[model samples]
Target: MLIKRVFNNNVALTEDLDHTEMVVMGKGLAFQKRPGDEIDTEKIEKTFITPSEGFANKLSELLDEIPYEIMVLAKDIIEMATSELNTELNDSLYLSLADHIHFALTRLKDGIPIKNALMWEVQKFYKDEYQVARKVLELIEARTGQRLPEDESASIALHLFNARQDCSRMEETVKMTAIVGDISDIVKYHYSINFDVESMNYSRFITHLRYFAYRMLRGELNDDQNDMLYEQVKMQYPEAFECSRKVQAYLEREYQMQMTKDELAYFMIHIQRVTSREKS
Candidate 1:
């Protein structure tokens, strides 16, 4: 395949089956490469589109900057999943998720499905994208006629960790807080922990989601909130109260947890906010 563009020392762009630009991640494909560089087809493992049509020139101008190939592929994966699912993902997330995907694909390929500390919350909160994730599993299965590895499902779910329909960063962070906060609440309620969300720990807890959401923005992944988040979820939130009951039941039954009250509230709030902002 022709090296359409070189993103970095380890990543290059080439033509995909759809005759569109896509990035391929592997070794030696990008070293000492120019725009018209020729790459061996065998070295091209996975190829997918890029947010930048001008990656070559853009990358060159950046000089000291080089993008992580795996992350670039992850961004491409998100684009693929969203397009396949007929869901529109925010473009900003492209840069962020791409980076996260690079780290995740390693763990995923090695058979660890959930790598981040907040993975359980990610699975619970990003339910809609789970449909997109499930499609990734199916896509892999169709290619091999064998079930895709479970970690691939986690890779896709991690896509949800960075998934967003809103391009607004502020709205994105707030809504993510709602989404993850609700997930944390559900888990806490299920375990019947002596929760107290009113304490500052609630703020600390939400901050973790905010930071994870921030990492998505920075195109880096730094997950510290593990099964050891020394925090609590309050039982007193009005919307949180409703989601509390519903998710509690859902968790006990081994079924998918629906969006909790806080999630829906923030979701609708941000949806309206983003739409109105876009319209205005």
Candidate 2:
């Protein structure tokens, strides 16, 4: 590919044979190069193919200002998250995360620390992603010699979660976080048991809660289907059903949302699994 514009010795903007614009990153790839110069394919470290023209332009601007290493780090983080979560992330993560990380480090250097209000919920619901985000902070400090606050982990986890859901707004992600946090607290207090947050049951419960919260916020509900399972669940796991009822009440009062009986049946099942030992 020929360079259409050179950002620096290591980065350039080029168009593919299909006339699709791409941001290319590599060490010394554009050294002494001008527009129309051929890009050394062997030196290409990364090429971004963004769906949005506006985001592509923003990414190009970011590439011009950020270091190549920082950009590569963001790409690596995205790859790791994709593999670990087994989800296709939004490509906007490349521009959004890289830009956030660069500025986060800058803020740290300026002695300005930002706290993530949803850190507790992020850690509890998105445990794996939150762990990876914490490790990313260590990686950032190791590479940049600038240490960010612990809250940054929650920020990173939010980005990972947002990418997973292909969410369009940060507000939606925050609302999801808050809903999960509230639901978790309700369950914990209702049962008076500290959830074994590391257990498989707890992990599965959190996963359920994430989508449950998303649906609640979006006003989505399961279709009304008369089923015997709700009666069976109430009989087999009365305490769990009661807890689920309390949760449903909380949701109704807080969010003005109601759960269908079919929804409550599945919720009772999850509640039973997670709170079974306590019941015993």
Candidate 3:
């Protein structure tokens, strides 16, 4: 491949044989190199195929400023997260995560740590992602010899969760998580019960809330006409149905969105299963 632009001694923009733009990284791969010069294949340690030209350009700019080792560390963490979570994260995670880590390390070295305000919600709601992020902290310590605080795991978990989502903005992911936490709290307070987070029922309930929150944010309402079943659920699971009604009211009051009968039915069913499991 020929170098299209040299960002630094270790990084450069290059094009594959088919003319697809790619960012290549290695130790001293671009030393004494210029545009149109042939890249040393043996020196190319990592090659990233960005999703868009704009993303590629932004990554090139980041590579010029960030250390090559930090970029490699981010790639390793992303790979581990993908394997542990069994999900293909968006390519944009490469840039966002690397940039985040670079600055986080800088802040830690300068003794100015930024705390994650949503740490409790993140750890309670995103257990899997939180575990993966804790592992990421271990990796960072092992590689960089910098021990970031435990609260940093919540920030990293949010990044991982946001990457797994279809929403482009991190703020949207934060909002969705908050919604799930608020709704769960409503159910808990209504039933006067604590949830076993490790329970299968609890996991299923959280999953439903995540999707529901995502749909709510996108203004996707389920208007399915399930009045008959809704009535049956209300009759059979009165307490659970009442808890779901509380959740409905919270959403309507805070978010200004009303739930359809079908949504209410499903919500009540999930609440019945989860709360019954806790009670039994």
Candidate 4:
């Protein structure tokens, strides 16, 4: 591949056989190199071939400033998150996450730590994404030997959440987080138990809440009142059903969103799983 532009000693813009521009990274891949020079393919560590030229330019600019190791680390995190979440992520995640991490490190190094106000919501709502964010911070510490605070995890989770949605905005992500946190709080208070947040039951509950919040945000109402499982759950787990009723009321009041019987039935099962004496 011929170098189209050299971002740094470690990264450069190159074109493929199809004449498509790609950002390629390696250790000293561009050292003593100029445009049109052949890239050392053996030293190539990663390549980004974006569909949009503007995005490619932005990515090229980001690669020019951020260190190659950090970029690679962010890419790995995005790949892992995509697999774990089973979602198709936008390529813009490369730019957004890398830029965020780069600036976060700079601020932390300067003794300026920003607190994430949405930390509680993110932990309660986007549990899997938050876990991935924590792993990202660990990777950053491992690679650069700088430890960031817990608040960074929430910010990273937002970026991951945004990447998964086709029309996601930061405000919408915040709303979803808030909704999940509120419903979880209602369930906890109604049950009067401290949940094992690390348990599989908690993970499953948060996953359901996330999707439910998504549906609510999109205003996609499904009133399936004839669900066969509703009566059984209402009869078997009276307490859980009562808690679900509170959750339903909260949604109705706060977001002007009504819960369908089918949704309430699913909520009962999740609440039961998490609030059971065995799990608690």
In model 4, state the lDDT of residue 167: 45
How high is the lDDT of residue 254 in model 4?
Answer: 84
Q: What is the C-alpha lDDT of each candidate?
A: 0.52, 0.82, 0.87, 0.83
Clashing pairs in 1: 22-48, 23-48, 71-98, 197-234
Off by over 4 Å in 3: 165-212, 215-280
**Candidate number with greatest lDDT:** 3
Instruction: For residues 77-174, write the lDDT of model 3, one tens digit per residue.
Output: 99999999998888789999999999999999999989775576567556889999999999999999999999999989988987883565688889
Give one digit per residue, the lDDT tens place, for model 1 in 47-160.
545666565454444323424543444555666777765756654455545444444445456866553444344555555566677675665455435454554555567555
Worst 10 residues of 2 by lDDT: 218-227
* Decoy 1 TM-score against native: 0.38
Model 1 CA lDDT for position 262: 42
Report the lDDT tens digits of candidate 2 across residue range 1-280: 8888887888788887898888888899999999998899999998877568686567668877888899988987888788877778888888889999999988887888887756665665567779888888887888778778999999998888778755555898898889888888888998898987887778878877886787667765665654798898889999888899999998888888878888888789888887886556
Clashes by residue pair, model 2: none
List candidate 1 stretches off by more than 4 Å.
1-5, 8-76, 92-99, 108-120, 137-155, 167-204, 207-280
Clashing residue pairs in all predictions, respectively, total 4, 0, 0, 0
Error of 3 at 5 (Å): 1.4
